[model samples]
Target chain A: MEIITSSKAMQERALQLKKQGYSIGFAPTMGFLHEGHLKLVTQSLQENDVSVMSIFVNPLQFGPNEDFEAYPRDVERDKKLAENAGVNILFLPERTEIYPNEPSFEINVKNRTGVLCGRSRPGHFNGVATILIKLFNIILPDHVYFGMKDAQQVAVVDSLIKDFNFPIELIPVETEREEDGLARSSRNVYLSDEERSQAPHLYKGLQKGSEAIKKGEVNPSSVIHIIENYIKTNTNGKIDYIEILSFPNLDTLEQIHGKIIIALAVKFSKARLIDNIILEIHS
Target chain B: MEIITSSKAMQERALQLKKQGYSIGFAPTMGFLHEGHLKLVTQSLQENDVSVMSIFVNPLQFGPNEDFEAYPRDVERDKKLAENAGVNILFLPERTEIYPNEPSFEINVKNRTGVLCGRSRPGHFNGVATILIKLFNIILPDHVYFGMKDAQQVAVVDSLIKDFNFPIELIPVETEREEDGLARSSRNVYLSDEERSQAPHLYKGLQKGSEAIKKGEVNPSSVIHIIENYIKTNTNGKIDYIEILSFPNLDTLEQIHGKIIIALAVKFSKARLIDNIILEIHS
Candidate 1:
């Protein structure tokens, strides 16, 4: 596998691949490869002649108070994991390379990103959209893989690609989980043992909400209340938000008509955890 | 020459050209097909194997009070002019196709766009940056051309392309002017016959500033005073802005070090006109 550190080098390599008629697939990540990241790489490899996995700990995506400094990173281990997952290229750009000076430009997706994670962390989605656009241009990937764990991110990126007419396909991979149903996240490492034990409650709460919707609950407020009450009783996790939004658009639903995404975010003593499930109404 | 009105058809044609080893050159314009736009297209034909020109009177770039509804457009005339200039494909996507809904996304450049015309028309650069990105993606040109009359716009776009790492090269064509020295623009149609006669004073003011800089005058206040006084005396035009700035960054210059751009804007009774000239100093 080829390893490149500069944007020019990556584009030159991508040009050569294009000359050979190879379809390129990209999986952009913030290093610290978990089972979740490997799943995306695996999916990318299956879809294209060449798979490129970029490990950039983007400083723009983190807020002033967020865990930018404390975010997990292990380059050697990530390289080994990506190689094993059949990635053809490992692009590890330095912070200066990704952002030469402070960025003077921004890409913002409205409405879909204004709720959920976007509410608490302002400018987060703008940062995501900006870096993603830069990466897409540098790599010229035919398809890009994103994890479903970042449901709002997927929606925002979808709208960005659509509105900008970026010539890339977006493929969303399902959330990778532990045996006990805790969603896999690099931040999960921050949890204490007791917090880890209680972390599964977030997913359990989502499952309960999905089950309630499966049982013909059409009202969004009632579903949100049930999920909120479940998390309050089962764990000491602080609720950030419990929202029942329409799938894809993420608009707040007055009545669940077609498909709805029930998303939740909770903060334990040690870490913040998020998870979601999509529900469809048959009638 | 092939004329395509749908974006999908144009992209497909561009991709086919790419596969067959053709270097794409693009010229994006708001279609009245003036001599200025033809100069850009003519340069594209000389430098590239295929030349694609897009004629889109982007509504996003016009302020609510600006002349969006009365903006001149003659498609049949534009087609003939493009063919005569040896353009290979003419892209004219409909307004609805380009803006399917109220655009939720905005691409904005900072620092550079806050002066001159941008001060009067809020959100104009945001709209320009957004539509240019869309056109760049759809056309996938090897080199894109813009007139240097919009010097601030060229600077902002140059910064954006570099910041985003777009693969296309930028070619800044010299401003095309009429015999009396008025820079050709679609908005020139808005000028009454008497107002049209006074339009050349904008260019005359730019020439006076450029000549002062050429004769070793580096004081910005002196340079601005000369141009403002010329415009104030020559025509009954309202001076919108007249400032001597560092060439590409558009920052206020304490002393002329290397390159300086002298820019001016004047509002006549019926139209707004802008012009500029770049002066390079050598040791």
Candidate 2:
């Protein structure tokens, strides 16, 4: 496996590989290697001639008050996991490498970012979109993988790719879970023992909400109510938000007879966790 | 040459050619092709295995009060000009085809657009940056060409490409002009006979100002004064603005020790014309 530390080097390698007709599948991560990230790499490996992963903890994507400094990173462990998972290239660029100077333009995301984690962390997805533009150009992948664990991000990226008419295919991998239905995340490590146990109920509440909708619940507020009650009764965590919106678009639903997402966030003692379930409804 | 009106078809053709190792050179333009547009195509054709030209009168770049509806377009004429100029593919997507829906994101350009035409026309470069992002993704060109007649646009595109790290090279073609030194433009047709005769002074004024700077006039205000006097005395048109600033970055100069641009705009009876001259300074 080739580990590239320079963006220019990565781009040059990508250019050469592209000219030689290699189909590259890329998964961009912040690099605390987990089953969630490997799942993307696993699928990427299975689908393309080459699998490329990027591990840059982008400072641009974190707000001024957010966990820019505290974000966990372990490049050596990430490299070993990438190698074990059969990734062909690991791109690990520094902050200066990604942004040699302050940018002159802003790719302001005006949609699909008004709810969930996006609402709480303003300017986050704009930063994501900007970094993705840079990464997309550098990597030049035929297919890019994004996990649905950060479902809003997937939706925002989908809008970006569609709105910009990018030729690359976006492959959204499902959220990897801890078997107890708890979504896998680096933030999961911040959870205390009891908080960890309580966290699974986040997913459990979502399941109940979606199941209720699947059983012909048409009102979004009713589904939201079901979720609110389920979580309140089951978990010790403070509910951050519980919302039902149109999938991908994230627009308020006038009716539930369309593809929708039941998403929620819960604040535990030490960690704030988020999860969602997207469903297609005919009624 | 093939005239593709569908962006999807254009992208598919681009994809096929790229996979087969054909390097594409692209020049995007608004229709009513002039010598300025052809010069870009001429270079593009010379540089790559395939030359792709897009004729899109992007409404996004036009302010609500600006000449969007009055913007000149002649696709049939443009198609002939492109074919005659040896362009391989002519992309002629309709406005609806380009925007199918109103964009949910805004690629706001915050720098290098504070002066010249961008200052008077807010959101113009943002729209330009946005459309270019869309076009770059669709065309996937190895090299993209832009005429330096609209020097501010060239600078903004420079920022966009640098900030996003687009792998495609930006080739800035020299401004094509008439024997009288009037910069070639479709809007030249709108100039009255007297206005036509006086319009070349815009370029002449810029040339004289740049010459003064070359001969060691360090103060930007002094340079502006020289150009303002020359244009006011020589032309019957109204002097809109005369500016001397750092080139490409368009920042106000603290010292005249680097590349700088002397630019101006003139409003005649029926049309507005702009011109500039860039100089490299060492002392």
Docking class of 1: medium
DockQ scores for all the models shown? 0.72, 0.88
B1-283 per-residue lDDT for model 2 (tens digits): 9989998999999989998999999999988999899999889988999999999999999999888888787877888888998989999998888999889789888888878898888999989999999999999999999988788999988888888989888899999999999999988998988889888888988888888888988988888889899888988988778887888889888667688888887888777888888889998
> How high is the TM-score of chain A in each model?
0.98, 0.97
Fnat, 2 decimals, each candidate: 0.70, 0.93
Instruction: Tell me, by lDDT, which candidate is best.
Output: 2
Query: Model 1, residue A277: displacement in angstroms?
Result: 0.5
Highest-DockQ candidate: 2
Q: Which 10 successive residues of model 2 chain B have the least lDDT summed? A: B253-262
Candidate 1: list runs displaced more than 4 Å.
none
lDDT of 2 by residue, A1-283 (tens): 9999898899999989988898999999998889999999999989899899999998889989777787777778888999999999999998899899889988788899988888988899999999999999999988999999888999999988989998889999999999999999988888899788888999989999889998998999999999899898988889889989988889988678788899998988767789999999984
Tens digit per residue, CA lDDT, model 1, B108-147: 7775888777787888988899899889988999999999
